[model samples]
Target chain A: MYKHTTDGLRTLLNIPDNYQIFFLSSATEIWERIIQNCVEHTSFHCVNGSFSKRFYEFSGELGKKAFKEEAAFGKGFYPEKFEIPAETEAICLTQNETSSGVSMPVADINKIREKNKEALLFVDAVSSLPYPEFDFTKIDSTFFSVQKCFGLPAGLGVWILNDRVIEKAKQLEAKKVLTGTYHTISSILSKAKDNQTPETPNVWNIFLLGKVIEDMNKKGIATIRKETEVKADMLYNYIKDSNNFSFGVEDPAHRSKTTIVANTAIPAPEVNKKLEQFDLAVGSGYSSYKEKQIRIANFPAYSVEKTEELVNALKKTIG
Target chain B: MYKHTTDGLRTLLNIPDNYQIFFLSSATEIWERIIQNCVEHTSFHCVNGSFSKRFYEFSGELGKKAFKEEAAFGKGFYPEKFEIPAETEAICLTQNETSSGVSMPVADINKIREKNKEALLFVDAVSSLPYPEFDFTKIDSTFFSVQKCFGLPAGLGVWILNDRVIEKAKQLEAKKVLTGTYHTISSILSKAKDNQTPETPNVWNIFLLGKVIEDMNKKGIATIRKETEVKADMLYNYIKDSNNFSFGVEDPAHRSKTTIVANTAIPAPEVNKKLEQFDLAVGSGYSSYKEKQIRIANFPAYSVEKTEELVNALKKTIG
Candidate 1:
C-alpha cells in the first residue's frame, strides 16, 4: 500500500519549493539533523515544551545562534517575538507541542511568516496534524509521526516539503555531502514521488498508515478534531472545577486541545503509581517539573469512556 | 519478534562511547546521515557492493575526502593496496554485501583496524549475523536489515551498541545534536537492552525476530552457518557445470555464501523477468549493472529441494 505522509503534509502546509525539507525518524531526529546540517544559518525556536528545548539544545550543540520566545507549557508561541535573524535560513516552530498540550494559532504562524519572508519555516506537527484547523500553508516544512495523529504504528515520520525545500536538497545533493540517508529529503522525494522507497521501506507500517488515512478521510479530520475538542473540554472542565486539582499552565488560552497537563494536590509519582494499578497510563512531568505534574492525552483513539475512567481514577487516587 | 538488522553493527563493532552513532531507517539512511553530519571526517569505503559505492557518492557530494577500494562484485573487501588516510576517522565496510553475494574476511578487517585505530569502523552485516564465523569483536559499529537474515517481516532495524559508542553519543548529546531519533544509538541501547524500543517499535517484526533467534540458538549458529555453506556450495556447483551461466564475481573465496550472484549470456533483466513467470523472483543487478547480474539468495529457510528447483529453472530458461 502506498502511504502519502509527505503529500498529506504538503496539502496541509501548502509548502513551496523554495524551502529546504528534511525528515528524521522522530521529531528529536529532526532537531539533531537540522543542527548538524544547517550550521551556516541561524534558527529561531518558538519554545513551549521539551521538544522546543531540545531544538535550543541542538542549536547550542552546533554552536549556532537561536532566538527563543518562551511560554508556559499550555501557552502558545508568541509570533511577534519570533524575529528572524538577519542570517536566519530557517524558523523552527512546533505546530502543536504534545508534552505541553499547546498549539500555535494559525494567525500566529501567519504573523511569523510575514516577519521572516526570506527565512524558511519548519514546524513540528507531530501531535497537531490530526486536528482539522491546522493550517499547513504557512510553513515550508511540516513533519509528524503516523503513530500520533494517524493512530498507526510508530517508526515512520510523515514530512511534507514545498518546491523550495526540494531545490535546496537538490543543491545539497549536487554539492555531494547530503548527510541524510534513509530519511534524506532527496531520497524520500525520489521514492515518494514515484510511490517507492530508496531502500527496503517500512512495508507494514506504511500499509497500516494508508489504511488509517483512508479511514480518517472517510470520518473527516473536522469531525475528529471536534470530538477531540469536546474530550479536552470535558477533562479541562472537571480539572478546573475540582478544588484539589489545578492546571500546570496558568493561562487558559494556552491550554492544549489534545493533552491536558494538570497538577494535583497529591504528589505526581504517587498519583502515577495509583493510576498504574488501575491499568491507566498518563504522562509524568518531564525535566524541571518531574514528579510534580501529570499529562493526560485525549488523542483520537482515546475515547470519552477512557477519559471518564481517567477522571474517576484521578478522583479516587487523589482522595 | 525481535528482528536483527545491520543496526546490530553498533554492538558488533563495539564502537567506543566517544563516537556518535546515527541510524537512518535503512543503511541508505546511514549514507545520507553521514553526509549531513560528518563533513569534517573523511570516509574510506572498503566494501565492494552497491552500498559501498553509494557511501562513496555520499561523501563525494559533501566534498568530503573519500576513497573506495573496489573489489570485484561478489568479492569481499581485500586489504591489498587499501591505504588508510592519515586523518581517516571512519571506514565503511559491509560485513556481508548482499547484492554482490560476497563476505569480507575478518583478516582484512583486522588490518584496517590496526592501521587506523582512531578511525571508527562501520560495517553493514545485514546478511551475516548470528551465523557461524560471524564475529563482532573488532569493529566499532555495524548494522543489518531485518528481512535478509532475521527471518522477520521488514519494517524494523535491530541496532546494538557498546559502552564506548554510547559515550560518543553522550558527547553528541552534550553537543545536543544527534543525527538520529528513533534510530538513535542511545535510544536503541536503553530500550533494546530491555527488549523494547524508544518509539512504538515494530512489535510484530520484533516478535518474529525473537522467535527466529530462539530457534537459531536451539539449533546453534554454528550448525546453521554450516548448513548455509553447504547450501551455497550445492547451488554454486550446479552453476559451474552450466554452460549458459557464470558467476558475477570471478573469485570463489570472495563470493557470498548467502546470496549467489550469477550472470547469464542473456541480459540479467530479461532472465529475471522470464524467471518471475514461474513465481521465482530473483534480484536484478543494482545501479550500473542493472541488466548484467541476477542474485539468488540461499537463506536458511531455502531447503536443498528449493535449490535444485532454482537450478532447474535456470537451466530451462537459459540452457
Candidate 2:
C-alpha cells in the first residue's frame, strides 16, 4: 500500500528523482517536525496570513529563534526586499495562504533559494500541490495534505525532501539534539526503504490516495491544471464585476488560483445560506475574517459547469 | 465528530467525569507524548514484549532516564516484588502484551498503584482495551487504538488521562521544560472542552469510531466482554488438548482473553493457508515468533458460532 501511494503520488506530482516522499499525520504536524528536525538555531518565515504565520509561531514555540518578513493580511511577500538572517538554518514559505487567498508565485519561491543559498527552503504547498508544476530539485523540502488538491479525506500528509535535509538531520543527531521519536527523519526514511511506516498509518487514506492519483493519471495532470485555471478565471472574473463582493487579495498577481477568497458586503453566513439553496456551500472566513469574507475552494471536484452555476447564483444574490 | 466520539467513548468505557479523552494518530504516538509530557526525569517499565519495550525505548530516545524490570517474552510481571525507584516519575505497563499474549491481571496493575502511589501509572491497553473493565479511577492514564478492540480502521488513538496529569504538565511548563506543541496537554484539553482538536484531525475515522462505539453501547459492554471470554476459553481449551498446538504463554493465569496465541508444531503460514481455504485467517506471531506461532483475535465482531467454525477448521487442519 505504501509503495502504491508513493509511486502514484510521485508520478502525479512529477516529483524529481532527487526528492523522496514521507508520510505524516497532517501539514500542521509537518510544521512542528520541520522546526524540530531542520532548524538548529534560527529560521525565517514569509508571514502574510494565518497559515503562514503558524509555521513561524511553531518555530518560536519549539524554542527556535524564528524571524519573519511580515506582510499585512491578503498581501504577498517581495522576496527581493526580504533579508533572512545569516544564522537562519531554514526559510519557510506558504505557496498559498488559505486564510487570505494569497499565493507566492513559483518564480518568487525559486528566488528565495538563490538569495538564501545556505538555508534550507521549505514551502507549505498545503492547499496547492499537484496543480503547481514545481521544479522539485530547486526546493529542499515541501509538504501538503491529501484533503486539499487530491480531493481525498483528511488524515495523511506527504512530505517531499531532498538529500540536504537528511544531511542536516544526521548532523543534528550527532550533536544529540532531540528530533522526535516515531516520525523522525531517519526512522521514517529507514521504513521508507522497506515500503513501510514506523507506525501503523492511516491505511484507509493511503489506499484512497493511491486510487485518486491513479484516476488523476488517467485524466492527465496538464488537463487538470488547465481546467483549474479556467474555472478560477471564471470565478475571479465574476467577482471582479460584482458590486457586493471584491477580491480578497488586492494584487491580481498574488491571488490564489486554488482558494478564491472574497470580501462580502453581507455576512459570510448569509452568503453561505443563499448558496445552500443551490446545494452548494463554500467555507466561511477563517479567524478574524469570519464574518467579513467567504472562501470558495476551487478544487478539481468543482467542475467548470458547476462553477458557472455558482457564478450565476452569485449574480442573482447580489449582482 | 469530537463530541460524538468522546461522548460515545466515555459511555462505552464508563470513563469517570474527572478523566478527559484526547485523540492522536496511534497508540504508538501516545507513547512518545507520555514521555514528553509526564516524565521529567525517569520512568519505570515492565518489559516483556515488543510493544512495551518500544515505550521504554521512546523514553530513552527522548533522553530521559528510563529504568525497567525485565521479564521473558511470555512471562508476566510480579508487581509486589518489583520496586519502582522513589524518583521515578512514571510507571509504564502493558496490560496485554500482544507479542506474547500475556496479560498482566487488572489486580496486578491495581497493585502497582498501591505500591508506587507517587508515580503516574500509564498502561498501554493497545490490543485489549474496552474488553477489559478497569477501575479507571485507580489508574492515572491509559491509551488504546481503535484498530484493536473497536474493530475499526487504523489511525485514531484514545488517550484517557485524569486531572493529576494536568498538574504535572503545568509544573513541567512552569519549570520551562518542553512538552509538545500542537497536541500539548494544555492545548488538547482546551480544544477538548469546546469539543474540538488543535488541528484538522482524522474526521472520517473519528466518525466511524463514534458509530462503532454507539453500536457497541447498544449491545452492552458486559455482554461483549462475556462473549470474548467464552470464545477465548473455547480456543484455549482446544489448544490444551491438541497435539499440534500448545499455549504460547506458559502461565495459564497470565494468558490473554482477547489475543489468543498458540505455538504450532507446523509453521504459522501453513496453518494460515489451511485456514484460508475456509475464508479464515489468523495473524502470524510478532518478531522472532513470526513463523512458529499463530495469533487469533477474539473481537466482538467474531460471534461464538463463527469461533466454533474456526475451532472445527483448526481440528480439521491438525486434529
Candidate 3:
C-alpha cells in the first residue's frame, strides 16, 4: 500500500524517477530529520511565519549552528535579501506558509538553490502540495502531509528525497555524526526497498492516500492545477472587492494559490459566524492575527461551483 | 480528540494519575526516544527476541553505552541473574515478545525495578497491551502501538511515562546533552499542557482509539483479561495434545497469553491453508522461524466461542 500511493504520488506530482518517496509521522518531524541527517554543523533557514520559523528552531534545538534570514509573520523572504551563512550545510525553506497564507515563489526558491549548490535544499510543502508544480531537480528534498491539498486526515507525511540526500547521510555517518536511528535516511532507504518501514506505519492512511491519488489521477493533475488557479482567482477577486476584507499578505505575487488569507474589518469570529449560516467554514487568523484575519483553503476538495457559492455567500455575509 | 483518547486509555487501563499518556509515531520510535531522553550514559536491555534486541541497538545508534542481558530466541530473561551495569541510567524490558510469543513475567519486572532503584524502568508492551496489568509504579515508562491488542490499524504509538522521566530529560538538557529536539520529553510535556502535540498527529486514528476505548471500557478490563486467559488456555491446551503442533516457548510460564505460538509439523503456510477452509487465518512465524511455526493473536477482538471454533478447526486440520 505504501508503494502504491508512493508511485501514484510520483505520477500525481510529477515526482522525478530519481527521487524516492517515503512516509514519516508528519511534516514537522522532517525538520528534525533534515538537521540530523544532512547538517554537520551550520544549517540555514528562511523564516517568515510559524512553520518556517520552527524549522530554524528545530535545528537550534538539535545543537546545530542554525542561522536564519527572518521576516514578519505576514511577509516572506526574497532570494535577493537572503543572507545565508557561508558554512551552512543545508538550506531550509517553506514553499507555502500555511500560518500566514504566504508563499515563497517557486522561481525564488530555485534561485536560492542555484546560489547554494553545495548545500542540501529542503522544502516544506506541508500544506500546499498537488497545487504546486515543483521542479524536482531544483531541490534536494520536499515533504507534505496528507491533511492539506490531498484532503485526508493529518497523521502521515510524505518525504521525497534524492539519492544525494541518502549519500549525504552516509557521509555524516562515516564522520561519526548521529543521524538518528529509526526513520533515518539510510533506514528509510533500506525499509522502502522491501515496501516496509522500520515501524508499523499508519496503514489505513496510506491506503486512503492511494485511493485519493487514484481519484486525483482520474481528474488529472493539469486540470486540478488549472481549477486551483481559477478558484483562487475567483476568491481573491471577490475578497479584493469586498467591503469587509482585504488581502492578509501585502504582496500580490507572494499570495498563496491554495491557502487564501484575508484581513477583515470586523473581527474574524464574526466573519466565521456569518459564514457558518451558509455552512461555509474557513480558518480564523493564525496566531497574532486572530482578531483581524480569516483564512480559506482552496484545496482539491473545493470545486469551482463551491468556491463560487462561497464568494456569493461572502457577498451576502459581509453586507 | 487526543485528550479524549488519552483520558479514555487512562480509565480503561487504570493508568495512574501520576503517569501521563502521550502519543508518538510508533512503538519503535519510542525506543529511540527512551535512549535519547532518559539515558544520559548507559541503557540496559533484556534482549530475548527481535523487538527487544532492537531497543538495545537503538541506544548504541544514539551513541549511548548500551548493555544487554541476552537470552535465546523463544526464551525470556529472568530477574534471577541480571548483570546490569551500575552506570545504567535506564533498564529496558519487553513485557511481550511479538516475534517469539514469549512474555517476561510482570512480577520479575517489579523485582528488577526493586534492584535497579535509581534507574528508570521502561517496558515495551507493543503487542500486548490491555492484557498486561502493569505495576505502573514499578515502571517509569511503557509504550504500545495501537495495532496490537487495541485492534486498530498500525500508526499511532501511545507513550505512558511518569514525572521522573521528564525530570531526567531536563537534567540532561541542563548538562548540555542532546535528548532529541522534536520529541524530547520536556517538549511533550509543554505541548501536552496545551492539549496539543508538537506535530500534526494522526487525528483520525486518535479518534478511532477513543471510540475503541469507550467500547473496551463498556466491556470492562477485568472481563477482557479473564476472557483472554480463558481463550489462551483453550488454544494452548489444544496445541499441546495436537498431532500437528507443539509449544513454541519451552517455559509454560513465559508463554504469552495474548500472542500464542506453536511449532507446526507442517510449514506454517500449510497450516494456514488448512485453517483457511474454516475462514480462519494465523500469522507465519517471524524471521528465522517462518517455516515451522504459527502465531495466533488472542486479542479483545476474539470471543470465547470463536476461539473454540478455531481450536476445533485446528483439530480437524491436524488430524
Error of 1 at B198 (Å): 7.5
lDDT of 2 by residue, B1-319 (tens): 8888889989988999999999898899899989999889999999999999999999998989999998998889887778889999999999999899999899888988988899999989999988888988679999999898888888888899999988898888788788878878988888989988887778889999999999999999999999999999999999999999999999888999999999999999999889888999888988889999989988888899999999999898876
The docking category that best describes candidate 1 is acceptable
Candidate 2, A18-123: lDDT as tens digits: 7879989889889998888988889999999888888899888777899999999989988788788888999999999989999999998888888878999998
Sort order, DockQ high to low: 3, 2, 1
Model 1 DockQ reads 0.40
Predictions' DockQ, in order = 0.40, 0.77, 0.87
Listed per model, the TM-scores of chain A against the true chain A are 0.84, 0.98, 0.98
What's the TM-score, to 2 decimals, of chain B in model 2?
0.98
Which stretches in model 2 have alpha-carbon errors above 4 Å? none
Model 1 C-alpha lDDT per residue in residues A16-107, reported as the tens digit of each score? 54433333355565666554444344677888887777777667545567777787665776666545567876688887777766777767
